[model samples]
Target: MGLKKYTNINNIQGKKGSQFSSQLRGINLERVLIVAIDAAKFYQKALLCNYYGDVLERPFFFGVNQDGLNLLCSKIEEARMEIQAERIFIGVESTAHYYEDIVYELGKRGYGVTIINPATTYEERASALNWSKTDDLDLYAIAHALIQNKGMENKLPEGAYRKLMKLTRARRSEVQKRALVRIQIRTLMDHIWRDYQGFVEIENNKPKKKLIFSDFWGKSSLFFMEHFPHPSSLIDLGEERVWEISKENKLRIKETHIQTLLYVARKSIIKSTEVVSAELLLLRLAIKDLKRLDENVGLLEKEIEKELLQTDGRLLLTVPGIGVVTAAEFYSELGDISHFDNAGQLIKKAGTNPIIIQSGGTQGFYGRISKQGNKHLRFMVYTVGKSLAQHNKDLRPYYERLKERGKHARKAFIALGNKFIKIAFSMLKNRKPYESKQPDYRIFTEVKKKLLYTKMNTYLNIALAA
Candidate 1:
């Protein structure tokens, strides 16, 4: 017989496409041993399998420490020798941070490691197996998933990008904390001054509503709260004394505001009692926490800005309405824009990709976004798009065009978000600044002319009828 050429089992197309077939692309399935680990905090369950997803060794238990890692490596070596395998692939679920150490150790020991999403393994278990869950079954599922290529290759940011991610996450945490503290402050104000919310001024024939204590936990507001602590105290102090206090504290307040504050203080239904003192104490403490959180957030922003300046993130700022924080967020989440082949992938990662619903022979209808990836990135992109739509030279017109085409305001913003991603992808990939060349304006001019003509014709007809 003539010599036959070797082919990967995954390359063969069967009557029904196998789920694992998609995963096996770009991977040589022949003469390869796949080890899948069901990782836990202290221990892990592992299964050794061949490229065909056939289990080679029964499930084994190993600790998460060095001893367990060594034993696991030894087992893999033995299996490789027995099967005469040229390659070994280790697949583990990216559950929390439990898999980090093992992944590091395995990579150091010269093994290819892939991180599988826990959701993927769960789906695999539900679809392929009829039996209840067990360590062995889970391990087998993970291995089979790898053979089918159901996981993404593990890639972590390093150097400046890593620093940027850390700083941005910290900033986001502090910002959220500040928001919570502001809410707590408002809740306390409700109890202390129930009628404070009704205080407003009529400006330009419209109600200009003011926040409680002038501004929420603002410097002057906090100082005033610290000194008076209650509306009754402000009432007792009177306008003159309160004005002197404001001067001493370097607070800028108009004479009318002082009079209004006294008026509200005297008319307030909530009186300060000994029991109310406790609420005041809590409110002051919450305000103090808010100040601390604000300081921390500011510091984190400075660090993030410094790190962003070192990267090509500055190019993102060339786009109108994209500031340092937004650029840093983009750079941190994306790491390198070159990893994505196109803007569509970037949009998908941001979870801004629209969903389509279809059944039977009915045409599909577009639904909301899938919201499958990084939520923070999605929010940042949406905010950036909103800002661009209002301010950016090119994007503003595009946004208006979408609205003119009968897209809802929110839907138009979503479209702008998608457009922003494409523009950002190109800008980052080319390492160039955004050029502010206006798009074709003739269409808008023609629309405007048509609308004006229609309006003038209506007015002329009305006049002739009269």
Candidate 2:
């Protein structure tokens, strides 16, 4: 309703001029804070500040730098003390790891904080019909989004979902760093060795830890490297030692394999023969580090699994294709499921929501996924759907159903993935575990959700007495 509808003024005491407050339920956001991050020294501010009849104060400016995090932490501390802040909302455009500490500082201090995606800000800016862009514009957009979107349904998220967000972001960072090191190892092995790929199959799945750590990379294949142990001494050692190591390693070699492994450890044209020794040392260390990261990633998966078991994941695993890991990812990121209103919302967020391509008058043909949701979750669903199509009897019929209707293989999988959405909705909404057709298994209950959320300690005695 527009603010204009509530015209007349009155107080319970029948005051002369006081207006009756007709504002709807929940806290009202009268004042807001926006923190924008940028690498440049100057940025244009473009905040058109009214939202839902609330006006934002002119934004105060601040700069972020290498050590700006310390200042941000102190600034938020000051804001908490400066105002009563009945409904203080803090918004920032999450850039790099800048938002990491900023969001952490503000959220850690107990303010209502939202680190908005750039898209959300752009959508809101479009609604305002403003085309200009600048740092100032962004700060205002952040404030506008906060006041307008706050107090809407589904605003509060479960605590666990936030934890999962942190974990995924941290994991991505580690994966990126590991790729850099692996590339260096690849370059070394390519230049310093000739038979490296043939022997180790590093080009295959990866420099697998099971293979690398077992004396396979150094001991089993060392003689096969382009610059073998000794170029001048291959004559003294003869072919016997090379043949013995090859057979013992079971490398599936013919007689030519030994010749290649023992080939002049130094070809006159070997480009970097001078650096071969040093390069080998670096490559070995890289393999060792890669092994450690592989183990760490596995440990993280197990931890996520343990926590998901406590939450509602049965709804996810009940589907034919989803396994423990996929189900854990679904529940962990999607939170309590009640946050979504229906199957459509779930599908849209899962990026399984189908999009229609229509022109001004003509109806267009089929289109692909909107692809506008949690990509990790969507990927998990797709993989599960693929597995189900291969091994699941129930899924086979659905796959055929789509194919008969002229859907492509990929389209068929998407159709099943869409159906998976409904199963998730039913499971999460009903607070039930997922079991297949038999329907006899009970997965788990949200223990806190039951018993009116009263503490199970001595507090229970007080409740009974009352």
The candidate scoring highest on lDDT is: 1
| Candidate 1 minimal-lDDT segment of 10 residues | 444-453
What is candidate 1's lDDT per residue for 1-466, written digit by digit as tens?
Answer: 9966433333342211233444444556666899999889877888898888766887888997788888998999889988888667789987876887788888788776887766667777876677535646778778777766666445556678778887887788889888898888778777887655456668889987664455645666677665666788888888899999888878887778778778877767766467677788898899789878988987887777656656777567556667667778877876676666688777766778898899999999988887655566778777777888887777898989989998888888878988988888888888766776756433223222322113434433432453
Candidate 2, 1-466: lDDT as tens digits: 6654333333331211122133222434333333333212343221223224333333444444434545554554454344433334456654444455444544555644455555556666666556444535556555665555421122333477666545654565567777886677667766655434444334566873222212334444533432243344444456787566567877555666456545534332354446676876776677678667766766666565455444556345445556555566656656556555577666666666677888989977658886655555576557667767875565678888888989888878877877766867787787655554534333223222222223434333432343
The estimated TM-scores of all candidates read 0.77, 0.57
Which stretches of model 1 miss by more than 4 angstroms? 1-30, 39-45, 57-64, 129-141, 197-214, 351-379, 390-393, 397-415, 438-466
Top of the candidates by TM-score: 1
Q: Work out candidate 2's RMSD over C-alphas.
A: 11.3
Q: Score each candidate by Cα lDDT.
A: 0.73, 0.52
